[model samples]
Target chain A: MDQNYSTIGRSSRTKQAIEINKVLRNTYLLLAMTLLFSGLTASISMMMNMPPMTYLISVIGGMVIAMFVLPRFAHSTAGIGIVFLITGLLGFGLGPILSMYASVPNGSNIIMLSLGGTGVIFMGLSAYVLATRKDFSFLGGFLMVGFLLVLVAAVANIFLAIPAMSLMISAVVIMLMSGFILHDTSRIIHGGETNYILATIGLYMTIFNIFISLLQILGIMGGDD
Target chain B: MDWMKIVAALALIMFIVYLFPRARHMMENSPKGSSADWMGFVVPILVIVLFVMLLVQLV
Candidate 1:
């Protein structure tokens, strides 16, 4: 009887392991594709030389879709399409800012450096979580608080437009995004998150935030602005 | 100053309003973080900041 019980337990664990692995694989694959699609849209928008204010409109549009449309369709095949659409809109929004920077001295350098920094930070944090398998769910509250604080500061800076304050807010946002990456990845690995679309969204948004923050920091500190 | 800045600020305030309750609930329900967990978060972030500084310098 003990032997049979042990056999059942082993198989159950194996099944669960397979499920988690499947979710992880699918989330990563979709994430890569969405990133590539976003990049394509960004390139197209850049070539068109969009106005700077277009960023606000496109970003707001993307956010509205993400907040309202994504949850309803997350379980369906259409979720994948919606995710691509949201990412593409966001990328298109970014083109105006990239164009602004490209016109400045060493603006392209700042962009490349920001890209390199974002890639490194994302890869490093992800590898650490995958290797250690440490649960970061405890970071939930902290990350949220950080995000709210950053938002408040961001709103204030709209009036202030102080370069120093803007730089500080961007740095803090990058840190908050790192905390979120850990928390979100932990949820997926421990099976708190079962949907790959949602998981990809969590990761994609974090990466997006990190990339933007890095760009701001580089532009400010490098005097590329 | 500009219409874009005004719109941006309003959007940010809305986000803060939208996120506040969820964050409060998460704090109330989620597991309390220990000092070690905080350390785990801070150390990597510090490294990231340093790495970013290095990138700035190199460029």
Candidate 2:
């Protein structure tokens, strides 16, 4: 009886391990594809010399999908399609920012640096969580509070228009996004997150924020040249 | 140099400090891992910090 019980327990653990691995694999594969699609859209938008209004519209559209469509379709095949739409819209919005930077002195350098930095940070944080297998679920509440505070500060800064404050906000966001990468990856590994679509979204958002924050800082620092 | 930046930086620091203990406690109780694994994560952070510092210095 003891032997049978031990075998059953071992198999249960094995099944869980398989399930977790499957989710991680699917999430990563889908994330890579979405990123490529986003890049393609961003490039197309840049070539067309899209206006600011396009960015505004894309931002609103992406938010609508994120807030409404995503949650509803997250478990279906449509979830993957919606995810691509959100990424494409976001990428389209990014085109104007990239164009603005490219028009300035040393702008291309700043863009490259930001892109490289984002890639390194994302890979590093994700690998760390996977290597350590440490549960960072505890960070969820802290991150949420930090996010809300940052959002409020950002909106207020638009009216206040303090450059130094803006710099600080970007710095804070870079750190926050890095922490999110760690937290989200850990969640997937520890089984706290079971849905690949949701997992992909969390990781994608982290990358997006990190890239934007780094670009802001680097642009300011390099623009004078 | 404005008061806003100063205040914002201070607030951010305080929040991180307050949250540090909880994170440390969790890490402490986590499964044993090789030191190399920890370095895998820390190295990236150090690189990112250096990049940020370089940008700030240029400002």
Candidate 3:
């Protein structure tokens, strides 16, 4: 009976490992596709010089799709299409902001730097979690609390309007996003997150926020000159 | 003061305040991290911060 139990345990462990690997693979594959799709949409809109109204429409459309449509289809193949649509629309919305950054002196350099920084941070932290398989799930709660405090500071900053405070908020956001990269990736590799669509959304948002935050910081620093 | 900005900020604050309790609950229930776990988390974050600073400097 003990030998039978041991065999069963090993088999279950193997099965669980297989499931985790499958989820991780699907999540990364979907993530890469979504990122590229969004980049393409953003580039097209930026090159076309779309108006602010168009950006506003795309953002609202993306949010509406995300809030209402994605949940219903999250379990189906249609979920992938929804993910791409949401990302593509939001990417289109980014055109104006990217242009705003690009207009500043050395703005193009700042944008490229932020993009590179975002890539390095995402790839490094993701690799750390994927290689070590360390469960950073313990960070789930701390990260949530930190986000709240950061939100509070961000809201307060409107009244403050201090450049330093704004810089801090951007830096904190980048840090929070880095933490999320670990937490989200940890969930995928530890069986806490099973659905590839939801997993892709979580990581994509983290990367998006990191890129934006980096841009804000770089914009401020470079603009100061 | 832009009242519109104020209203938007207030709405955002309200939304986040609404999320606070759930975060609190999670904080109480989730597994606590040890020193090593925290170190594992912080070291990479440090690297990111430094790398970002270097990028800023280079530009």
Candidate 4:
């Protein structure tokens, strides 16, 4: 009787692990495709002279729809379709910055630097969480508060029109997003997030913020002829 | 910076964040059916398609 019970427990555990792995695999594949799509969309938008503001609004709209409506109604093959929709929207949203950078003489260099810098920060933060194995979930609340504060300051700065303030906001964004990456990654490893799509979205947003902020900083400091 | 676009993005992000917890709850309560499983691909594909279409039109 004991042996039979142990065997059943082991099987269940294996099943759970398999499910988790499947989710992870799908998340990674989707992430890769999203990145590729973003690149292609940005390139095309630049070629076509799409207005940056229009692209930005579309991205914002799509993000809201994806996060709210899609998740609610998407319970079938349609759910998968929603995922792609979100990814593509993100790509479109990214088009403006990509195009703007491309117009600069050294835009490509700046982009590569931003990408590399974002990658390094992500890997570093991820490594820290993995090595420590300590739950960083506690940081979530703090990060949210910090992010909001930054947002407010950013808005105020627009009216204030202070270059120094802009730089400070960018710095804060980089730090906060780095923290988010660490927290989100830790949540995944600790099984706090069993749904990998959600997990991927969270991580992707963190990385995006980091890259955008870093690019802004670079542009401010070294974007002259 | 266009304030309209910025505000729209901020509003959308806030709305999504507000909905996140509910979405998770729904996912948890729903039966693990194949239909639910298939929805996983829908969002990502839609994202790609919309982006591609937009890109083509823009280019």
Q: Which candidate leads the pack in lDDT?
A: 1
**Sorted on lDDT, highest at the top, how do the candidates line up?**
1, 3, 2, 4
Pairwise TM-score winner, candidates 3 and 4? 3
Regions of model 2 farther than 4 Å from truth: B1-47, B54-59
Candidate 2 residue lDDT tens string, A55-90: 656765786687668999999999999999999999
Q: Write the per-residue lDDT of candidate 1 for residues A1-225, one digit (tens) a residue.
A: 999999999999999889999998999999999999988999899999988887898888888888889999999999999999999999999998888888898999988988888889988998888898888999898889879988998999999989999889988988899889889888888988999999998899999999999998888888767
Which model is ahead, 1 or 3, in terms of lDDT? 1
lDDT of 2 at A64: 65
All candidates' TM-scores? 0.97, 0.82, 0.90, 0.74
**Per-residue CA lDDT of candidate 3, range A1-225, in tens?**
999999999999999999989999999999999999989998998999987656556755775677678989999999999999989988888887888778778888888888888899999999999899899988989999999998888889878888999889989999999999999999888899999999998898888889888888888887632
Question: Which candidate number maximizes DockQ?
Answer: 1
Q: Which residue segments of model 4 deviate by more than 4 Å? A: A1-10, A73-75, A127-132, A223-225, B1-59
The regions of model 3 sitting more than 4 angstroms off are: A52-64, B1-11, B14-18
Residue-level lDDT of model 4, residues A1-225, one tens digit each, is: 999999999999888778766765666676676667766766666676778675667666676766676767554556656666676676677777777886787776767777776776677666666676656665555566667668667657756878878878987787778767766776676667777667666776777777787677766666331
Worst 10 residues of 2 chain A by lDDT: A136-145
**What is the RMSD, in Å, between candidate 1 and the native fold over all Cα?**
1.1
The candidate scoring highest on TM-score is 1
After TM-score superposition, the amount by which residue B19's alpha carbon in candidate 4 deviates from its true location, in angstroms, is 8.7
User: Candidate 1 has which clashing residue pairs, if any?
Assistant: none
| True-structure lDDT of candidate 3 | 0.86
lDDT assessment of candidate 4: 0.65
Q: Which structure is stronger by DockQ: 2 or 4? A: 2
The digit string of per-residue lDDT tens for model 2 on B1-59 reads 45544554454455455546655665555444456645544565566678777755544
